[model samples]
Target: MPAPTSDLASFAIALAEELPGSWTTEHHTHAQYPDQFDRAQHVWDMNLVAHAIAEHVLGQDAALTRDDGTRLYVVARPRHGEEFLIGAIAPSGIPAEAFRTVREPDGIAVPDDPVQAAADITVDLLPRYDKALAQVHDNAARLATTPAPELVVITLTGRDFHVSKPERADAVQVLLANGCVFDKDQGAFVLPGGDTAAQSEAIQNTAAQLSRLGVGLTVQPSRTTPALDTAPATAPPRTTAPAARTR
Candidate 1:
């Protein structure tokens, strides 16, 4: 089996990156029949099988329809194990499927041909894929509303301050609107000058807004805060008490 062309591979990578979850290249070892000499071919065959299942059983269109209206395309990403993340760009949004555990016939002779194998696998797996996609959508929605931990970290860097882990998109936007410029090379948001008071106010406002949106913020301790390091004064030793006890 031939590997996916460079163009197809690039498109898949871009699509996967655009989506919310982490995705990796689809490798032959990740295929159901890893021992097969033509692993890429097997994957391609499986993709075709999945597309057919989507059309016939799931009532979905091909991942990609060519301008010529002759050929269709499907791209897939491999997870750590048997799961394959498959999708195609659509007019409205991405139509995707996740195949983790595929159903197979009981004691029926599985065909050696890749196309037939894909068909068999698809028949069992398509339903599972639909269910998984639904669950993924639900989880994503829940995560959006659920309060995240203090993922953003703010650190004082020389005369400026840098913000790290700005996980929330809205929080980043707030920071940017309030004069925080993202340093692409450093992968952080930088606030210029040593105006501690002004910086503090900005940080507070950003935190408050993000908190309202269920996003968390963590501010690094400022070195200028001597008060934080100062311990309460200990009482002087009772020298007079010692003399009185001796007398």
Candidate 2:
């Protein structure tokens, strides 16, 4: 016979109350493959693991799905004779899943005291939860700072052009090889200046070269020296530009 509905409902009620969330329950039955003995055996073994020690005591296993779609399985026969074990059956693909326990040895045990277990789990996981959240924020910050190939600034100083640093090492070397000097005072790579027509041509050629190599350049008069034109670097262009001539 299936486990008493009252017993399942009672356990779910206790956990839901402790967690204080909208939760719904479902009867979980192990899938059987009558035509395939090996498959059936494998599923049975997996179910045994999923149900934990509660298989024999509960006579049936069940799951609780939160309003947010996170599922926690019921372990009726918790080790140490605890009343029930509420834990994830699989990774829920959510932040909570990172610290939420399972039925494994390393997983947190849900004792008879559902309220206390909930509190303890919160306390135990707070640091890790905060850390996980922090890591996500840190990654976003890194992405925000990533170089924008399209915003490569080329400022026309009195004589030469002051170019902002490109993130690529190869791009840096290319600039250095083409008679560019790193000016510490200006914090930009200085390109030699010449006749107006020749300088314009050279700048355009260099810009095109950089563009081919997945970099961009924006030429502006030196009056805008203090700020480098910048934008969030998106994925490089898919189509190739014609081979750029060395300046």
Strongest candidate by lDDT: 2
Off-target runs (Cα >4 Å) in candidate 1 are: 1-150, 221-247
**Tens digits of lDDT, candidate 1, 1-247:** 2222324344444433433334344322211111121211112122223222211211111132234221122322211121223432111221111111111111112222323423543455334444544554554455546643545655543346677746667778888976789888988889764465676567667767766775555433222211211212432122211110000
Against the correct fold, how does model 2 do in TM-score? 0.32
> Could you tell me which residue pairs clash in candidate 2?
54-77
| Model number with the top TM-score | 2
Q: How high a TM-score does candidate 1 get?
A: 0.30
How do the predictions measure up, each by TM-score? 0.30, 0.32
Per-residue lDDT for 1-247 in model 2, tens only?
Answer: 1122336556565655666467777654433211111111111111223223212222355566668654555545533455554444332222221221111211244556656655654565333434544553453455446553434566544356678888888778767766678988977898765554555555556665776786655443322111112211331123322221111
- Candidate 2, residue 217: Cα displacement in angstroms equals 43
Pairs in clash, predicted candidate 1? none
Output the lDDT of residue 90, model 1.
15
